[model samples]
Target chain A: MPIPSEHQRPTRVTAKESAFTQLQQWIIDGTLQPGEKLNDIELAEALGVSRTPIRESLQLLEVQGFVKMYPGKATQVTEVDKESINDLLPPLAAMQALSTELAAPNLDENVIIELEETNNRFAKAVQKEDYFTALKIDEDFHQIIVDQAANKYIHSIVASLQTHVRRLFFHNSIILTEKSIDEHKDIIRLLTEGNGEKAASIMRENWLRAIDEFHSKKTD
Target chain B: MPIPSEHQRPTRVTAKESAFTQLQQWIIDGTLQPGEKLNDIELAEALGVSRTPIRESLQLLEVQGFVKMYPGKATQVTEVDKESINDLLPPLAAMQALSTELAAPNLDENVIIELEETNNRFAKAVQKEDYFTALKIDEDFHQIIVDQAANKYIHSIVASLQTHVRRLFFHNSIILTEKSIDEHKDIIRLLTEGNGEKAASIMRENWLRAIDEFHSKKTD
Candidate 1:
């Protein structure tokens, strides 16, 4: 409910929120690589805003572990550690399990068809070797499960945690992408058939497989 | 590595770090209640720092979901959202469970003894009905398990997540204090007896129990 006051400026651009969004996108897009320096004045000039909003954006980024700042130092983007990625799985599995549990009861024929469509899109994207497109579609497909769980709280956390998981897998080997696509196919098949337990179990294992892939890449 | 340039006479405090820590503590201590207004100028004055560090700290807090800053309006402390907390748990649980698994091999007798000491202190604190002391001891006990796991990365995420968990449980009920101590005793006893499987299982269950207690109080 705490709305920004700097509204109603007739300009096409709102500086602060734009800065925040841009910074966040840079993080998501890996434009600003991990451990990269974020200089305030320079960034302010680049973003065409005052140092205030840029600084604010950096602080927000820091909290998400995307940026690190210390006393008397410029903040830098940071990588999620491999071990942290490994450690990130079980809870994700738990939440996904919870989601599937909830979704199972609520999922109707329409929802199943919709998820199946997304999953098919993901499969086509994978076959075309468009990993990025596959990734987004895959996200959309899984999101239905979490969304249908009807717990906004759990879904939010899963959303955030899933970002790190995706980013990790994105940077790791290509094999994970293939494995993940295959896994998605099976999960969609199970969900479409209303095999809730199998769907949930596969979803959980999918994350574990991703975790293992992450570790193998880390040591490699 | 990008250190900021300092002005004349670097004050007794590292302005940025102090603001950061103070802002975080204020949230944790409930001095800045949920949905409270956080004026940069006023908060800067109160914390005895300039707007620069205060701004930086506010941004940091914002990223972690502690504060919400509007562009022109004053930043306000954030309200607790159950969805966000549920979102927070997967990474937390994953890290804790992973740490427990890792510590299974490395939890030596001496470390178990130290954990026992911490557990005993928790019990004594509980007997004296000092919830704050009990909380500290309980945190110490868990930290040992995380430390023994030898994965600093997972440890850090788990530690950060624990802060939010602490805030929720501390404000909501006394049950975590009591249940935590009782569970800590059991966990330590099992660890000492080298029942790693049971100890880890209990540790995982402890988180679930705490979360359930939080939900119960939240609904009430």
Candidate 2:
């Protein structure tokens, strides 16, 4: 077969990346349970790809601490060990705290109003038992802080740390809607008043509180 | 042909992981410059692997923020702008500062001595112009602090951040030998005195100072 010309366009989505996305979603959505062994043949067949892509997907998962690979044994979705799970808290707290700090000086009157509107929407979403919408609104509020910070690398790294925390949020039994919204309102109030230190401290506390709730469930 | 058993041992290393390792090394070593395109077909042929593994490796690299992929454009090593890099520092500093604080209280006397000895070795290596060995010693000293922190998740995340920072250090012309030894001694002194706060603060300053040096070089 002749090589594709340099000007010829490849498909937008590559097979290997597709497998990676699907596998990641499966893990996140709990379709793949923790410690479930991933048979390469079965995964490839399920993913409608060759074993090469399936193997590659597994390696990516392994690096994210989502999957464990044994030399002679099968690759399995990793169980969240207590220590590993709790260790996520400090960095999450730090990142949120930093985001708030960076965002405080940058927020103008219009942005503060926008943040309050988002907070109000989050409250309504929680009241209506719309966890999905609430999650999005919640994420958006935090995203604004990082976006305003104008740090692409920092924002990206924080985004990765947030992914790890999202799994715990799914498992959390606590309805943080009311408390979180209230705290978020306070964050907005502080930012509006130009109280950066208090805003950052409160944001850090918000993350720590969520972590505490998750740990309580983990222990029980 | 008889199929291999599912339980068949995977004694040999997989080709995919090898390719991934090589790619990661290139990015870390600055051999693959930021914004440099990584053509899958070209990389695969050069590395003696099929495109499958190379594409998978790129996916992982994308998640790590080492590479960026646009649907129509080429996949290239990412060049994070300065603003985003600054946004990343606070949390990293917070994480390492927390590590130092936690480590100070829990560090065993012998481990503290071992770290000091590693610092001395670093000084010796620097004196002999063995930059590689000096670098390893520097890594070991910081690692000892992380090991004492007793938080694996924090260490893992910080380790990822270190990968990017190491590149900055590579370009930094500062010998860092005399000043690093002095800073290490100060840190050790504070730890021995059971001054966790002071030790953590000093460590934070050391990192901040390094970042200042990094920024200066970038501008120069």
Candidate 3:
């Protein structure tokens, strides 16, 4: 029954896209609880669109595994399992690493300065224990490199995988730390030196470490 | 007008899915040429369904970059770009390498033998210069590792990217040769020995080589 509030909805190029993006974000951020049935009629009214775009958005959401559709029946948000981290991180790590490698040779002074400023804010947010702000900042730092990579396939794929990653963070209390802040420094230095291979390995490790942290948290 | 014949349509559990799969394949294989407008009514009749499912299928296809839809206007298949190889291969190579690494310690004798047999058939097909069969058999060979890796995210993502790769191959006449067969043998050997790092490197290189071939072919 929960849908994004009027003020919180995304503004997209089309009614369908706006609905899909808002629905996907709500599901990812836990605003829409898993296993909750989605009412297309209600969603359409809330999004200020007709049922047609809402139905089309749900079909796209089904394709992305955010929701499940049952013919002549209800649509429900898919359950979130911590174990999905195992399935999610490996591919995400590879894509992030490839993005960094591709971006390394191309990093300029302006981008390097931007990376440092973003990391400073990220480190401060982590220090303040404001993990939500910190995680968003982390995405901004990585976004610089992802933009530099300029490969549309990697761009979209990484964005999709990172949605699941953000969901995990929301559910499991954001596994980042001062250690990650230091790793970001190493990443920046490696990129500055144009040593793309080492930068890529660090970037891969930067993500791979999260899996280990997830296991340790699970056992605790 | 070039929709797949009824006999060639893919069967799915739902009408919407069947329409989606068949339409996607038609676009990928160039049965529906780029810039060609799609009519939902005709597609619905061709696939023996209602227009609703055809519309839904087109929505999904647009998200996958196979189509572009205009509100109150026609939908058309997107163009195939040989230059997409630059955007496609790096991320794909990374995922494929990670899949290989994840599968290495897990590869049993049965999978190894399957790889060997698949490679043998692939080599024979290449020798006969039947590149279509050769390319499909190549998919089977890597699919062994992909299955062994057991990562659903990677499986889905690699499948999506590889679809674009296949379209490029089809458009560019399948830029493969005998050298790829030898590399497949080496890939099989390294995977069998459980040397995951070396195996991953080879897997990455195996896909990366296609980029050079794409460039060389572009020049020609």
Candidate 4:
């Protein structure tokens, strides 16, 4: 008998993992509001799957702090707290800076062109006041460097934190400032010049700036 | 009818979580070797519980990357790859350094005295060549700062990565050097002096030194 390949295996586990990812995305994009009830049955119906996968996904989400389970009661999307934002942003910034630093030496002309195109799209989205589109493009721009860094741990850490950050973006209709675009351009130039440290520093500062703006807007 | 208190409720979930933590510790301490098969029945017997909690724990352990599960087959502990160590260490160091930085201003004289006591125990454990005891004490010393930092995100991130670091300690019989102790003293001094940045920098350097030593040993 021959061994079965991975794809030949049952889809139950895959469905559960994908459901988890989908629900997480929903939470991040504000499709599922914070503190809103999450009924496994309703989610199953919406996703066109059985309740089992939704239940499994909810368990994982609870473990990841995206949801809260009340054991025999109800599961609800967790509220994105301001203190959590303050606690998480610095580490997120550090990880992004480290990613850029590691990615600097690996950048080639083709990759640089790809990044430039993404940045152009980001800028255009911002100019058009398409906050969601700009947010997606901004993620794509940073993701390129994060992928290039090739550090699974950093990647996983950032991916986990980014969900909360995205929630912040959703809750606050943050306008993309020209300063952000210029910072991106500066980062690109630094990378091109092979100045990893300066690029990393600027990337960190960029994140800090955004965080400061969020706090300022919140107070206002 | 009156509502039952949390303690009066069923203990199934708590048991499962505790079992997971126990198994993880076993893996980190090398009591469960990498690639060792995890038999639910055996684990249940050893843990003095039914196989249900063990089975649930195994599922979570699989999700956590501590164990690999094959559907309808076997579950096994994961190997500690050098590449994973390299990828994880920097982030771990950054979080620990951040913890120290945040905790510095809040470090009261009592907390400082407690830390000193822990470090003295750690040094004695090293002098006595009790690697396991030293490891435990070292964890205690750093954990104080992490707990004091009061940032659940950083605390959680460091806790997750520290499991892998402990596994590395188990796999390699790394002797605690005099330099390591001196570095701890320097961090304490900086913290006492209210120099958060310097303390954080030293803490980072201390962790980086361990990673460097591990790499050199691997090459040898």
Q: Which CAPRI tier for candidate 3?
A: medium
- Computed on C-alphas against the true complex, the DockQ of each candidate is 0.25, 0.39, 0.52, 0.45
TM-score of predicted model 2? 0.83
Evaluate model 4 with DockQ and give the value: 0.45
What is candidate 2's CA lDDT for residue B86?
A: 55
What DockQ does predicted model 1 obtain?
0.25
- Kindly provide the TM-score obtained by chain B of candidate 1 when compared with the true chain B: 0.81
Against the true structure, whose TM-score is highest?
A: 3
lDDT of 3 by residue, A1-220 (tens): 7865787534338887788889988988888898999998998988899999899988888878889888777799999888899889889888888999999878899999999999999999999999899989999988889999999999999888888889888777656788989999999999999999899899989988989888887632
lDDT per residue (tens digit) for residues B1-220 in model 4:
7756667657356676788889988988889989999998999999988887687677667766789887667889988776576787888888888899899889899988988999999999888889788988989999999998998778778888887777877777655666777888898899999999999999999887887777677632
Give chain B TM-scores in order.
Answer: 0.81, 0.82, 0.90, 0.85
lDDT of 1 at B6: 68
Give Cα distance to truth, residue B54, candidate 1, Å.
Answer: 2.9
Off by over 4 Å in 4: A1-13, A37-51, A70-74, B1-13, B36-55, B69-75, B218-220
TM value for model 1: 0.77
lDDT of 2 by residue, A1-220 (tens): 7866766655578677799889987886668988899999999999888998788778877877778888567799987554445677777777778778888888888888788888888899999998767877888888888787766656766776666656655544334547998899889889888899899999988877876666565543
- The lDDT per prediction is 0.72, 0.77, 0.88, 0.83
lDDT of 1 at B45: 91
What is the Cα-based TM-score of model 3?
Answer: 0.90
- Report the poorest 10 consecutive residues by lDDT, candidate 2 chain B: B168-177
